[model samples]
Target: MKQNSLRATVRARLSGLHDAEARVAHVVLDQGAQLVHLSVSDVARLAGTSASTVVRSCRRLGFGGYQELKIAAAREAPPEPRDELDPLTATVRAAQEALGGLPATLSRTDLSSAAEALSGADRVLMAATGLSGAIAVDAAYRLRALGLPVDLPPDPLTAHLAAELLPQRSVCLAISHSGATRTTVETARRARAAGAKVVTITSYASSPLAEESTWVLLGGGQDLVFGMEAVASRLAHLTIVDTLSMILLGLGGGRSERAVSASAEVTADHSY
Candidate 1:
């Protein structure tokens, strides 16, 4: 099976397992390649579980033993080939991997909730910082083109103000790959306090932004050679945004068709 599919399976099964098994599973899913070099006892110790439990967990996942499970996981894992590629190719590949990782990470429930929020909102506000700020603007523009009332805050202060001004029954959507952006988290908290529903698209569901959100969208992440390169996390976040846009379009029904047509007509006058 593809790595993405395997990841989905692991996530789906995670919560169903007992705590010890869950911890073991998390270690395997989160650090699969690293685990290949560790013995069963070492992995068990890392997960705070007994070695026998680790073996049982491996069996539950269809592996005959812990070693087999590690081998399978390593085979499905993405190659960290940064050193083998030129700068441009590595950068492009990282983005591509991130995009590829999106579908499995996102949940249908989250997408549906986001669509409902957008459809019911008086207005929608999106905010991000740095590279994510550009993505927020693009998402806002797309939603606007689809006839949704959307805004993108220009700065952290403006974002906070916008969050505070969110009326009851409105929606505020925050985008952050790290899920630790202080401004975004604070804005989301304020929006929620103001009685507007808040949605967060982020790489970590356990992140602070997720803690403040009514709806949480998941994305994927990959280690990168440099912090500046657009790696898997950014691409995953963009894909989540794109998926949310599509969901909103579907929710708008006939209005979406008209809005898209208008956008096409407006774009016809512009050239590269």
Candidate 2:
């Protein structure tokens, strides 16, 4: 018999759960298909929570018991055999699913705070390296469109120097998917040491970049579409930039409208 899917429903309720139940939920959510076969005790050991906690969490999800949870999980598991879809369809579906989870994972309050920080900063220096550097540049342009003072240099050394020179009320926002990018992390650290606020846009909340940040804006959803260079991460970062831009615009009043209009007029003649 078919059972209602609980994976999505359970994840949505994770924050409302008790610590022990939440831990068990994280294990189940992270393990996904693998959990379908793991015994309750096995999951307890992996989540570092007790088997009773797992059972309780399952019950909270409306399951009659752990066995019911496993049964439902198996029923809702991804289509058997990984290669069920053609290559193109699989790629598109993967990207879609990764992007689709953003709405649930991202925090509106955190994003709003980040936007305010950027909008109210004395100066803004955005930093990243390699692929993420491109994202930094894009964010700089988007912020600049609102007439906000934004700087993003392609050179890592120059970017580092800019961060080190940031004064009070200034901000250095670093973009990194892994939060472990060495140059970006160091740049953020130097900026914070220089008396500037440091903001990090990353996927991991506990990463080094996040640790160095005064505020963190999560990109929402995992960026496993293709690893570090995954296009999905870039999309996530861009979404964050766009969200901040809109918030800043709303807070800017008439001034931001004028800036955007002026930018559009200037570029209008250059476009086909």
Candidate 3:
């Protein structure tokens, strides 16, 4: 039978149930989420009935027992009138689903190479501009907190200039949503030309920025579809940055101790 028809059957059988069982049935129809999540005891509490009464209610409504009733009700339940999510909640839920699929988009070999280069680099120079520049600033602080020497140039022009002078074996970590940002790309190019390994986080794997880098991390952030990158892309990039930071910390020993020592010492005064 159709799901709606199945639920209708339950309601049709409701009128003949004993009074206590009818009360439990009313609670089931009124609170759909309860049918899916609440236990017999919980439903009993909500309906002001005994747990045994709740089970009998399910049997009268054509279920073998409470668990069967829950499964049948959950599978056949109609959308409740009050079922709605506000904008902020809806966005976070969408982002959560997208982030769960991130591992498939990112390449393991590329990630391993990027981590090794970052761990061994003489220093890391990160280049970005516009909104992505803010991500770079935050990422630099995170890497620095791990005891790594990281630099984020103050502007695109400065980034290009700084990239030009990076020492061999250094890493240039580029942050760009489009991967086509001219100044950011040029900075990565200059870093590569200087023999620094260029590691990139970008939304497109086919972008020019990906072409110049030793390793590229792909993040097809949803915000890119709107022609300008913002919230969704930032979260994707931040997730990647945070994962890398945790990996670096796991290597342990030198600089990781900065968490308890030098870095903490400096920031401790600002907190309270």
Which one is best on TM-score? 1
For model 1, state the Cα shift of residue 188 in Å: 0.6
Report clashes for each candidate as comma-separated counts: 0, 0, 0
Lowest lDDT 10-residue stretch of candidate 1: 4-13
Cα misplacement distance, residue 58 of candidate 1 (Å) = 9.5
Please give the lDDT score for candidate 3.
0.75
The lDDT for every candidate, in the order shown, is 0.76, 0.74, 0.75
Top model number, lDDT: 1
Provide the lDDT at 133 for model 2.
Answer: 82
CA lDDT, candidate 1, residue 207: 71
Q: 45-71, model 1: which lDDT tens digit per residue?
A: 899989999999877655688987776
Q: TM-score of every model? A: 0.77, 0.75, 0.65
- Is candidate 1 or 3 superior in TM-score? 1
Give per-residue CA lDDT, model 2, range 60-137, as digits (tens): 755788887777677654533435767566555545544554554557888888788888888999889877888888
Q: Please write out the lDDT profile of model 3 over residues 245-268, one tens digit for every residue.
A: 777777646658766377788898
lDDT of 2 at 24: 86
Pick by lDDT: 1 or 3, better one: 1
Give RMSD to native, each candidate.
5.0, 6.1, 16.8
- lDDT of model 1, residue 107: 79
Cα RMSD for predicted model 3: 16.8
Alpha-carbon runs more than 4 Å astray in model 2:
1-39, 45-81, 220-229
